[model samples]
Target: MDNLSQYIDWFRHSSSYINAHRKKVFVVLLTGETIAHENFSHIVHDITLLHSLGVKLVLVHGARPQINAALSGAGQELRYHKGLRITDTDSLQIIKQTIGAMAIDIEAQFSMGLANSPMHGADIKVSRGNFITARPLGIIEGVDYALTGVVRKVNAEAILQHLDKNSIVLVSNLGYSPTGEVFNLSAEDVATEVAMAMQAEKLILFVPQRGVMGKDGQLISTLSPVQADLLLKELAQDESVARNITLESLSAAVKASNKNVHRCHLISFADNGALIQELFTREGNGTLVSKDNFEWLRQATINDVGGILELIAPLEAAGILVHRSRELLEAEIDYFKVIEMEGMIIACAAIYPLDEESGEIACIAIHKNYQESGRGDHLMRALEKEARKQGLTKVIVLTTQTAHWFMERGFEPIAISDLPAKKQQMYNYQRKSKAFIKTLR
Candidate 1:
């Protein structure tokens, strides 16, 4: 019963994400390692589920390991220049054969309809063609890259047409040139470019590990492009670290983010349901590389009163927060700061002046969907900064249920009498909210 209730709660929470992602375009990169993993079928099943939910998917696949095996079987050694394969005529032939076979296998997986399977009755149609145009990498530093190429253009119109028809578009790491030659390409690069050209809502890359890790080995859930670049620079400086797949995917994510792709996610192919979790859950199972301004924090206006009230109504009903009328909020709206994502206020806090030396931080609330993701901490910090800017030396918060949270942020317990005289006179002893104060240096 408990598990069933939890499932119901989770489903209810996921409704918002479902509506947000409906009819959105997503470009997913599947490396050779990802495709070869045992969980590949599960990933395909998830993709089918997304398709059924009206998500337009463009799948870009790589075949480096397969190409290497084929080259070894043909008694040819793999050659590379600066992490890019140096594809000669013979190598290109082998790569084309390997990538084509893999594409066929992927299409077959999408065609699965066994009873009791996730893909059963999915009826997914996949489209693939000369959707990518390429130009050779050319010679660099006295070495010729031969048939190795980079994406010159993506046929966005053709891909959109397929997407409009509700077919999943499949693209291989092979690009066709105007000269009638197919050049070997990087799957990550292809995915990034396709996302940029199509203006996709998301670019999801499947890596071997559980997203980007910090020095403490914990997954870093979010990063701005600048932060990602700094991390990449730090990784590059370490001589013990060889160029790996994760770094490549991160680089691609950063590139996509810079090119106007709003969200680029790096998720693990080894973890079952990672894709779905990353997409639907608030605390995602991956690292997100996005623009810094994706979420805006600013002073709330009269237009934000409705959102603010909606955000705090549940807390007010539960007696975790004191209720305020819309008229009262509109008149004091200038004192509030809100964190807005997609024009919706997800978190908000207000600083009311109690005296010249101190202020009261009140009405702190974060939408349940955004809780536990650090928005509360962010709002608190912003409020503290605002308090300091107002020449205040101390900030006080009264909480019935979040006393520990305030203490964690350097607030110390204080008596109601310790609050400013004006605030103390107006305090309601009936609610019995605990008072805490922080001295701002």
Candidate 2:
């Protein structure tokens, strides 16, 4: 396709995301290293695009690298105890200077308006203030953290006021105490606290690469809070694994997910379009950490077999789903994923890979009580992600009554001959299930 055609197609698909993200609160955390990277400008432009689309953005920035640089220049040694910085009086001054300078630089970048530039005519108002309250870490194991502190509270009301007025709230990794003292804070903590306080839709953290990769060297695209915690434990115990993981960003993502932030994203700061790609596409470019229970979706297990049977029994009796024996379900349990609510499986779906580039989406069933709420769509999308991970480029569904629904979600009618030879042979003529195929990009 030509560049123009590709652009048009991208914009067409991105329209849904544009509509979905409007007025949604997104807390984006940028590390000092990210700000200093060459890709920072591209990230800023994407952020401006989001702002233009009416997203309420809160940018939390860190100055760790800048502070270390300043301290080194001033001949001051950096001290740390158990990964917590020991900020003395002299180092505190450097921290403040570094943070203030980086904040000013960020504001300057956002303020840019040049002809023929991405920022042209993009009038983005940035609001920055001491919206975070903190208390000193004080004494820990006979070690006084001095000016280093943890986030005690976030002034969400003030931040929301700025957001309500269409201004991007800028928060640095520095907090003010009630005693009129300033302390160095962790940017991840600040972002997490702000997200929780405001109940933001997402807490996006910038990492050095795509996202959390598994031992197999592939990106783990999605993770529940429980999964993230387990991964953290593994990383902590294994030195070789720890080298490949960004412990801090993953920790924050897990925390935000657990605290009901709805979604937390770990995106690569070095990738110019990671943010946009993650937010606006069906298969996001980062790792998403979400809750595992009632409000989330996850892989099915042997324990979920009973719930799956209960969920599909109604559909099976109505002839909407093919009946599966308990033995079969147990044997193929790993092929399914379900959405549970209060200990009940409300929806379930499974995908069986037929070939290197094709799969069959089957056993899709949603509870009668939740038909119109888009649960089916959720299951389909989850299956698509799974299909992609399996190296499948296309997914086909055999349905007797849900053809129209699948078609609405971009599946197209296809003849049975188009399916894999084995699948075609297995097709029962009496049931006469319609075949629908969807190509994954």
Candidate 3:
């Protein structure tokens, strides 16, 4: 019964994403390495699930590893110039053959309808064609990238038509020129260009790593494009690190975001259900790149009451926060500050001014998942800034719990008598909450 309840709660939360994602176009880039991973079948199943859920998918796949194997099998040297495959005549043929085989395998996966599996009853139709036009990269630094090319145009109308007919559009890392020649292209380039031309809602890139890790070795959940660019520069300057899949995906996501894709994601291909978790959940398991802020502190609006209530309800039930009634919250909504992430409030606090020089911070709470990230301190800082704006010199907190948290933030313990007259009169002796105060500099 408890497991069932958890499922219901998760479904309730995911409904918002379902509603928002329906009929939206998402371009997903899969590298040769990702497609060959042990979890690839599960990833394909998840893709099928997304297609069934009304997400218009444009899957772009690469074949570098396959191409290298094919080249080695034929006794041809695998070559690269500046991190890009130098596609000579032999390499070009190998690239085409490798990409063709990958496309077939992906399409076959999408066509699966086995019973007793996630793909059961899924009648997904996949469409593939000459949807990309290319131009050669030309000679650079005396190195001619013979058959390697870059995207010049995307057949957005054709792809949209297939999407309108509810078909999953599959694009390979190969493009054609008007001169009737095929050119080797990067899958990331294809995906990013298609997404930009189609104005796709998201560009998702699968990588081996979970996501971009900060210097502290923690996954940075969200990054602005500007921030991503800086990280890319830093990575470029660091010689100890070899060029890897993560950097490639980050470059693609940054490119897509700069082209106004708005939202780009980098998720682990090895992690089962990562695609669903990244797309449907608030505070996703992977890294999100966006033009707009994914999480922000803002003054609360009437519409935020429900999210704030949901955030603090657990604390109230645990007797850590004072329970707030909806009616009272509605009346004092303007006094609340909330940290909202992807439309859900994760932390919140409200201030009730006791006198012109002082205010009492009330209902301070941070969701359990966010507490270890120092969001509580962030909320307090925001509230302190707000209090200063309101000409309050002192901020007070009454707590049965979290007194230590307040103390660590420079708050000093105080007697109940030190509180304002009205606050002292209304203090609950039965609750036995302690008082702590901080004076503004």
lDDT of 1 by residue, 1-441 (tens): 999999999999999988999999999999999999999999999999999988999999999889999999999889988878999999888888999899999999999999999988999899999999999999999899999999999999999999999999999999999999999999999999999899899999998889988777789999987688889887765444223788999999888876668899999999999999999998999999997676788999999999999999999999998999999999999999999876778789999988899999999998875566567888888999999999999999999999999999999999998788998899999999999999998
Alpha-carbon local distance difference test for all models: 0.91, 0.88, 0.87
Question: After TM-score superposition, what is the CA distance of residue 240 in candidate 2 from its true location, in Å?
Answer: 8.0
For candidate 3, report its TM-score. 0.66
Q: Which stretches of candidate 2 lie over 4 Å from their true place?
A: 238-245, 292-441
Clash list (residue pairs), candidate 3: none
Model 3: per-residue Cα lDDT over 18-109, one tens digit each = 99999999999888988989999999999988888899999999987888888999999988899888888867877777788889988898
| 1 against 3, candidate with superior lDDT | 1
| Candidate 2 weakest ten by summed lDDT | 237-246
Evaluated against the true structure, the overall lDDT of model 1 is 0.91
